[model samples]
Target: MGLRVQVDNLMEHHSQKSLFAVVLGEMQDGGLPHIGCRCPRCVSGRVGYAACLAIVDVRGAETAVYLLDATPDIKYQLNPLAEWLGPHPQRPNRFNPPTAVFLTHAHMGHIGGLPQLGPEAMAVDGLPVYASAELVALLQETRLWSPMVQGLALRLFSPNQPIPLAPDLTLTPIPVPHRDELGTGTFAFLINGPGKSLLYLPDIDSWQAWDAAHSVLQTVDVALVDGSFYSLAELNGRPPVAHPLISDTLAFFAGWPGELVFTHFNHTNPALEPNSGAVATIQQVGAKLAHPGMRFLLD
Candidate 1:
């Protein structure tokens, strides 16, 4: 099986998760889901607040595509993954193995993609979407989302529980602390293949809150940590809420004992400037930035 991720664009984070997109696979249909669409610099795409990250089949054959964080750009993100996978609007409602959808959290950018499961898009008869219990509850409690789930037949699973995704793939949910406004319960994912592994953490309030006393840190091939804001110093205009910035995140990785990469950035974060002096500081710590079009092939 082939696995890779592609970025659509970097977002502008003033209020929400203003970050970028990362594409996992291209579509079998024509170039309808173009990455350049909707970026601040791209006139051809839509204006977006979140970035779309997709995981695709490596050989351009049959494979599963998981949209890491749904993002406000959910339509743009799934447009490609659905078309590429066998679940497009024109395809039959046949379930395929090794296929699954994992949600990182309840935030709009994370779970907004839930609606695409309907007949309007994927026509997924009963697509199993793995999310925390609270997230499923939140969706059920809300108005629009509640109806969406009730109609789509989305399945909820507990965090930290490993579920088989394919004959050779398994996914485990790792809950991370974040602003629990929606009460969906936040999480990072650990996807394990036959011999490869990956950790996906997008929006955590602080690493210190995660598994506080557990050892979930030392066990993965690639750990994508948070990159929301650069530092506490970046909080200039914001009134006070409680959350850690990218600076605090940098501190966590200083001692982390695994291959670590950082993503989910905000405009306030200095790491956006790929060549900026502040980003250079993040690099000095041995942590890396997750940008559009960067792919990691599992060994």
Candidate 2:
């Protein structure tokens, strides 16, 4: 088995314009699938996806990569991550591109990388993709997504079920409310691998949407939650296409029994400018903003 578990917890930062490339994910080859632009709001636009994350294998014999959300800039995003892994040719089967990908919704930013995944591209064999039943069916029935669903096996998972991806890593999908064109069943993954566990729900509409009947907050070691917008009135770009704000989310986590970090930022949100009042407020509540290279060590 391989040895370190890491979450490429990256995000693109911008003020009224672009900021430093703390962990910038660049799109090097091929044009993005949907709309294109060069402005800060366009390039770093929340919907277009300024940053994408790739979860690399730390210890498994299969050096697989699990893509949490495939941002529009994926072609550029995969290059750096692949380079970082380099080629361990001498080591048996150490350089496969990625074993599979897991998507949250049908948003262009989330699944825009699907084309690259087909036979014409990576030519991956049955790259098992995980998503809700509705999301899978929609991808299958739709013209744009039909090829991807057929070219690669799109594994439709039931809400609140667990699927094992590695000897140590299993993904638990927590259903969240969202506006999926097919139907809403946005999943919050409970990724448990060997000794570490992480909870991801980066696109929920609000905390009030959860099932208060159960104590879902204490179920994991760490949470990377929806911080798409800072407030309802921030009224920035594209209205999330449908997602929640940070204010309500932060309050929900105030009583959380585990560590909660935020991700999926919008350009208009003040939190984009680090150390701004918005950033301070989030930190004051004992929560952290998701840092791209952040790693969690489990015993």
Candidate 3:
């Protein structure tokens, strides 16, 4: 089905007891309209937020929302969840913060929006934020971010261990090979819900670098893997990019059982254009390009 139809179906069942994962943004870390470039996509005023996802559980008396990454576009990203977040206790015309946020790594697009939760903005109190031990230490040691870090209840999570969010929902962090400069490892979250499971792996150096890549992909119902670049030609003579090229990714997962969805696209990626040959190739292979508001039902 088309993405619009899928979104409508999810919204229609919002009141029912269900668990779903929604894409908040699907662009690469820099996001669309990249910093200084005047590329055709950027010059045309096309916009896309950084890669991020939110898991919503409506199975309990109160809905619970959890974020996969706190991107720079978080303010706009959170707008869609306003109805579920409800009103803020003391602030008018505002919504409550998410129940928690899970960080994949320390990239700017992954943890950049944290400043919005500090004293100057949302001023959230005791918000639960989960991340790797090294990442947590890095945030706490950064003097400039002390104000924001103070409000967060930073929790450390181990790789491959399941952290239960509800009786039927659990999130497991699986270490993946990625460019890590701070000695803080990267992760690809494996979310297990009541009826289905999903793997949110927005960034990875290459599928070959991870030993369990194929096995892990086979275990999930849906795999939102990295698609940062369609080809190295988009790099414009820069050094080789770390992410797996879309072409290689397609060949890597050909005939895999689980649904393969590509995301985290760079501004230069031709796949962003609906009619581009890259997109058509992906469609021909039964894979899909993820977009904002794309919903994957887990239960």
Among all candidates shown, the one with the greatest TM-score: 3
141-228 per-residue lDDT for model 1 (tens digits)? 7897765665444567776788775566667787778888766777777777665677776667666666642377666777766666
Q: Rate the local accuracy (lDDT) of all candidates.
A: 0.56, 0.60, 0.90
Tell me, what's the RMSD of every candidate? Answer: 8.7, 8.1, 2.3
What TM-score against the true fold does each predicted structure earn? 0.73, 0.75, 0.96
Question: Can you write out model 3's per-residue Cα lDDT over 1-299, one digit (the tens) per residue?
Answer: 33344445656767687789998889998998899989899998777889999999988888999999999998878876777777998999989999999999988989999998888888888999999999999999988877677999999999999999998889999999999999999999999998899999999999999999877877799999999999989988999988999999999998788899999999999999999899999999899999987889998
State the lDDT at 136 in candidate 3. Answer: 96
Query: Model 3 — TM-score against the truth?
Result: 0.96
Listed per model in order, the count of residue pairs whose N, CA or C atoms clash below 3 Å is: 22, 9, 0
Model 2 lDDT, residue 296, Cα: 47
Worst 10 residues of 3 by lDDT: 1-10
Residue-level lDDT for 283 in candidate 3: 94
Mark the regions of model 3 whose C-alpha exceeds 4 Å error after superposition.
1-10
Candidate number that wins on lDDT, 2 or 3: 3
